[model samples]
Each structure stands twice: as structure tokens, then as C-alpha cells.
Target: MADVARIAGVSSQTVSRVSNGFPGVNEETRQRVLSAMKELRYRPNSAARALKRGEFRTIGVITFTLSTTGNVRTLEAIATSAAQEGYAVTLLPVAVPTQDEVRGAFSRLGELAIDAAIVIMEVHLLDEARLSLPPHVKVVVADSDAGDRYTVVDTDQAGGTHDAVNHLLGLGHATVWHLAGPEESYAAQRRTGAWRAALEEAGQVPPPLVRGDWSAESGYHAGLLLAERPDCTAIFAANDQMALGLLRALNERGRKVPEDVSVVGFDDIAESSSFQPPLTTVHQDFAEVGRRCVEGVLHHVRENGLEHGTALVPTKLVVRASTAPPPRKVIPCS
Candidate 1:
């Protein structure tokens, strides 16, 4: 430190400020300190600095998997938002969805150097370990039903699903068939409930449900079943990838989209617009959800308090070429 200070012709405190990324050091002087450190090959020890500051300003993100679109996008958003807030994100992935695995992640978190945590998995395990953490640990939950036990930030899953179902009904389809995600996902459950509610609101009976694992393969098989049904005029998939597979199945079965079978999907991912006929789907503000999660953690850390309530981000329907009024009835020859 002294060597760099002497070379840069600046005090050790000025050099320290530039290295730690603290403000109040002007640009020219900061540049000089950085040059000196580069020339001397001096590296600041982050752990020692964090101890001196009494806070790591890092958030631990505990999640299960990144195989799905929602998980990956949400995590990316969290990292971006955390960086904007002058903090860093560390991922703690749980290999399995078991309660023991979730609990073990949180247990290991206690030994980590993070000042806060943003949990991105099922809250059933978190609920079970409510009192496991010390009083200083602050938490923000994403994509789970924590039930007011923790600050929650998530998309408007139910409302988006309801809009999707009702959109098909409004376009003259008698009923919309649903291809749902796995039973274990809270997001899938919310969408399923909303689909049922939308049908009941319009005084129509919902068709039977087909379950999928949020994959194109699952959706392809489910599409085959729907293809066999003559009255399957409209289908709503839980995600865009499933919609892609469903579209492929419908095409192979000679069912023309919007001409014979209209389709709607949730999560208007980037590639959705380039699908064979393009997709008409719901758009979720995943970036906004991530930003709110970081904000929730920051609020708790800075204010010495947390809001034990769920924060909802809005969603909307994005109409495209894939949906239209149900196909006209064909007149039978006498």
C-alpha cells in the first residue's frame, strides 16, 4: 500500500478509496492510484475489506434448477439488478427439490459471507425452517407462496392465465384446452386455478386438463392426445416451448393453426415471435420481478425491517398470428 501510495504521489487512504470503488475521489486522482496499483501489481484483499466494512453487500440466490426459461431469466435479472445496486449475487443451487436439499442450502447459507438472501424455490421447505436463521438474516422469496412469512416478488401468474383463457373464449371458442406444467410448481398451480376460474366466470365448462413437465416433448405428446379430439378448437399452453411442440403436432396432424386450431401460450419468449406462424401469448415482466426482489432485500438490509407480503408484477396478453376466431363450420353435402 505504501509503495503504491509513494509511486502514485497520493495518500494510502486515497488509494484505498479508489480500490474499494468508493466515491469522493475525483476521476484523475482515481486513475493515478489505479495506474500505480497496476504497475506495482498490488491487489486488494476483498475478505479483509468486507470485514472492515462490516457488510459483504452480497446476496445469496438459492434456486433449484435453471433448465426452465423462467428460472434462468429471473436469475439473470437478479444479477443485473444487484449490480446496479452496488451488490453482487452468489448462486447456491439445490440439486434436487427435496425438502432436505432445500433445508441444507439454507443451512450452508448461514456459514456464507452474504448479508442477505433471495430464495428462488418452493417455500414449503422455507416455511418448515422458519426459525432456523439468526435474527440478522434477511430474506426475499421469488416464485413461491411463502404466505406472508417472507417478502415475496413474483409475476401475476393467475391473472395472466385468466386473460389467456378468456381471450380464447372471447374469440368464439367454446372452451380452451389446457396443457399444464408439473403439479409441483406453484406457478403451474396458479395458472390452473385461474384457467378454471375464467371458464366458470363465463358460465362454461372447462375441458379436461393435460399435464406436462414444462418441456416440448411433454407438450408434443399432450398435443397428440388433443389432436385426436375433433372438438379441440383452441389450446392454451403453459409456456412458449410447449406451444412450439404443440404447433408441430397440430401441423403434422393436418390441423391448421387459426384455421382449424387456435393456440395461446404464456411467457412470450424471444423466439416465440419467430415460431412457424408466430405465437399469441402472455408477456411477463421477468426483469421487473428480479429488480423488485433485489429492492426487497435492500430495503430489509438498510431499514432494519422486512415486509412480509407478496409483491405482484403485472402481465399482459400479446396477440399475434397464432390466434384467431374459431374456424367456421363446414356444411355437409346432402
Candidate 2:
């Protein structure tokens, strides 16, 4: 502090004010202080500042896995929003999804230098972690039904799924076939439930669900099974990666999308637009979800209580050439 003040030809108090973003300092003084800080490669000690302020200006992000699109995108949005809010993000990765692993992470909570935490994982893992954290620790969750337990920021899973299913049915398909992710997945559960509900509401019997492990390979295998079913015309895949594999399977089986069958997927990933026939999908506002997670945590940290419940971010159905009116006659799907 002394060296920076000396270099900038200002008092230490002036440097402090500039660093803290106090408004009293003139613009020129602020620039000089910042320039001096840059020249000296001076970085503020967040831990010390947090201690002095009685709040760590850091957020702990505990994630089970980053392999999935939703996880990765949500994490990215969290980091971006945290950075914009002048907070550091600390990653706490749980290699496995076991209760013990989650509990272990919770045990380390006291040692982490963070004011609040945002957890992204399935409901079961979240339950274990929730129990292990300090009773007063502020938390925000990104997936699953945390109910009244914690502040939650999630996409409109049910609404998006309903739109996808209804979109297919509205296009004249008698019923929509569903490609669901793993049963334990919260997003998958919501999507699958909505798909079935939409079908039942329309007086159409929902087709049997084809389960996938969220891997494109699993989607490919599920696709092959669907391809063999003559009644499967319109497919709603849980994600874009799975839809990609489904596309391949359909192609190999001589099924022309929109001609013989139509497909819609979730998570309008970048590659969905480039798929062979392009893909229609539900676009989850991951950026908004992430922003809300940070807001929920910061709100709790400031207010010192969990007074909020689920904050929903809306999803949209992106229509493209992949979806169309079903063929008039019974056509061989495979």
C-alpha cells in the first residue's frame, strides 16, 4: 500500500478509497492509483479483505460432474456473473456421486474461504451435501427440487418439455415418442413427466419412454430401438448430444427427418443447428439461471437468511426443419 501510494504520488488512504471503489475520489486520482497498482502487479488480498468485512467476497461452487451440457453451461454462467459482481469462484469437484463424497465436501465447508456456496448436482447428492454444510451457510442450488429447503435457481424444465411435446403433437403426430435421460436426473424427470402429461392432456397415449444415460452413444442405442418401432414418428430427445446420435441412427435406418419422422431436443447446443437436417430443440436460458444462482446466494448472504424458494428461468422451443407434420399413412419407421 505504501509503495503504491508513493508511486502514484498519493496517500495510502487515497489508494484504499480507489481500490474499494469509493465515489469521493476524482476520476484522475482513481486512474493514477489503478495505474500504480498495475505497474506494481498489486493484487488485493480477498481473504484479508473478507475477514475485515466479515464476509468472504468469494463463492464456492460444488459440482458433481461437468461432463453434461447443463452443468458446464450453468457453471460458466455462475463464474461470469460472480466475476462481474467482484467475487471469486472456488471450484469443489466431487469425483463421484456417492453420498460419502458429497458429505466429505460438506465437511470441508468450514475450511473454505467463501461467504456462500452454489451447488449443482442431482437432488440425492444435494441432500447429503445440504446436511453436511454449516447450518448458517448460505446456499443456492441449480437443479432438482430443493423445495423449501434452500434457495433454488432452475430452468423451466416442465414448461420446456411440455412445449416440445405439444409442438410435435400440434404438428399432427398422434403421439410423441420420448427419449429420456437417466431416471435419477431431476431435469430428466421433469421433462419426462411433462411429456407424459402433455400427451395425456391431449387424449393421446404416451409412447413408452426410451431411456438414455445422456451420452450420445446411449442416445444412438435408444434411437436404434425407436427406429425399429413402427409407431414412433415424432421423437423428443432430452438433449442435443443425444439428438445427434438419434439423427445418425435414423439416417442409417433410412428414416428421413420431417419426411418419415421428426425430432426435437433440449439444450439447443451449438451443434444442433448443424445437424444433418438441423434440429428443433428447447433452449434453456443457462445464463439467466446462473445469474439467478449468484443473486440468490448473495441475497441470502446479505440478508442472513434463506427467505426465497425456486426462481424459474423460462425456456423456449427453437423450431427448425427437423419437426413437421407426421406422414399421412402408416410408414415403416425403420
Candidate models: Cα lDDT each: 0.87, 0.86
lDDT by residue for model 2 (213-247), tens: 88999989998988887778899999998998999
The RMSD (Cα, Å) of candidate 1 is 3.1
TM-score of each: 0.91, 0.91
- What is candidate 1's TM-score against the reference? 0.91
Total colliding residue pairs, candidate 1: 0
lDDT of 2 at 283: 97
The residue pairs in collision within model 2 are: none
Global lDDT of model 1 = 0.87
Q: Lowest-lDDT window of 10 residues in candidate 1? A: 123-132
Worst 10 residues of 2 by lDDT: 125-134
